[model samples]
Target: MIVVLIGYMASGKSTLGRILAKKLNYDFLDLDDYIEEKEQLLVSDIFKSKGEIYFRKVETLYLKMLLENNTKLVLSLGGGTPCYSDNMNFIRNTVKAKSIYLKASIPTLVSRLKTEKSKRPLIAHLETDELLTEFIGKHLFERSQFYNLSEVTITTDNKTEEAIIEELVLKLF
Candidate 1:
């Protein structure tokens, strides 16, 4: 009963994963947080200190480690997790894991990410809403090839958190 939530940034993977894990009484693991704990560095710090290639490798390694060692868990992946290093392929083929994509429109993402930009390394340099919007649109477009492979795709636009969770529970159960 391992559930993996995937999406672009600010798509509610972490927020929804926490509540879903609680409702199901499963262990909740956010891979970025897990990596921070394991490496003793924030994800952004890892990217800054070691570079994205290194971060991606370590992320892939840690992702596989978590999937192999855990069960009855709800996992929230980093926004870029699926887009990197055959990770999507591994997630899709893993036994006992159900992958769900939290789909959000570029506008929805732009709105959410605008205020949270400083906390996100990838878009931290983006200074304008226009720039952020463009980046999200392009990024999501490229990532959709991978994200669309999810076992379930839930559109999060205009949906309440509880409503989204209810839909997820219905689809999952």
Candidate 2:
């Protein structure tokens, strides 16, 4: 079975994926990191040099390849993975993949993202707190429908990584 964790940036997908994979004794694949390795470039670089359209094409290719090589694995997908192209539908239909959405409040997301802005590509240029909050709110609202399609939705507000993982494990099995 494949476990795909999807959420907005700073929603703890990678961290929770790692913990969940460990708990299940399955391998873990971070979709962004996998893309970076395959493309031999940082995701930020891809966005800067070729633009989002090109990068998402590459993302789709890599996503398909990963699914082909499937074993029992936990995958942490990018924030926009499900929102773009046919990626969400592909995941839903491909394997015994169970989708999990990590839901975080706007304020919680803003606080978490502020410190790690340098790492994420899409929201890196968002400077002011007000602007960042508003931007995230708009994006989150727009993407909520795709996110709500997940088989399990877990709220991550004010929860430690371990607690979230525990909740996810229970919900998943």
Candidate 3:
């Protein structure tokens, strides 16, 4: 089975995916990291040098490649991965692939993303928590439609990683 973890930034997709993959004894692959390794450039660099259109095209290409080629895998996707191209549709239709949305409340996301702004290119420009909160609110609102298409939706607000993983395991099995 291919377990695909989807959610907004700082919503614990990568962190939980690593742990979930271990528990399930599945191989783990983070799509952004995979892209970086394959392209020999950072995602941020890709966005800066080639622009978003080019990045999205390659992103879709790799997503298809990974989904088609892997099994017994836990794939962690970028926050925006599903929103662009027919990526979500492809995941939904893929056999043996289960898409899970790690939903986190706006406040939860704001708090988590506060300290990690520098690491995230998308939210790095906001100068204040209020701005960050507002940005996340609007961005998540826009993205939630795509996210809600997941086979399973796990709300991670105020939940420990262990608890979230426990719930995920139960739901997936």
lDDT per prediction?
0.94, 0.90, 0.95
Clashes of each: 0, 0, 0
TM-score of each: 0.97, 0.95, 0.98
Candidate 3: lDDT over CA atoms? 0.95
True-structure lDDT of candidate 1: 0.94
Expressed as tens digits, the lDDT of each residue in 7-112 for candidate 3 is: 9998999999999999999999999999999989999999999999999999999999999998899999999999999899999999889999999998999899
Candidate 3 lDDT for residue 17: 96
Best TM-score among the predictions, by candidate number: 3
**Residue pairs with backbone atoms closer than 3 Å in model 3 (clashes):** none
| Tens-digit per-residue lDDT, 1-173, candidate 1 | 79999999899999999999999999999999999999999988898899999989999999898888889899999988999999999999898899999999999999999998988878989999999999999999999999999999999999999999999999999
Worst 10 residues of 1 by lDDT: 115-124
- Candidate 1 collision pairs: none
Candidate no. 2 TM-score: 0.95
Off by over 4 Å in 1: none
lDDT score for candidate 2 against the true structure: 0.90
Please give the lDDT score at residue 40 for candidate 2.
Answer: 93
- Candidate 2, after superposition: displacement of residue 23 in Å? 1.1
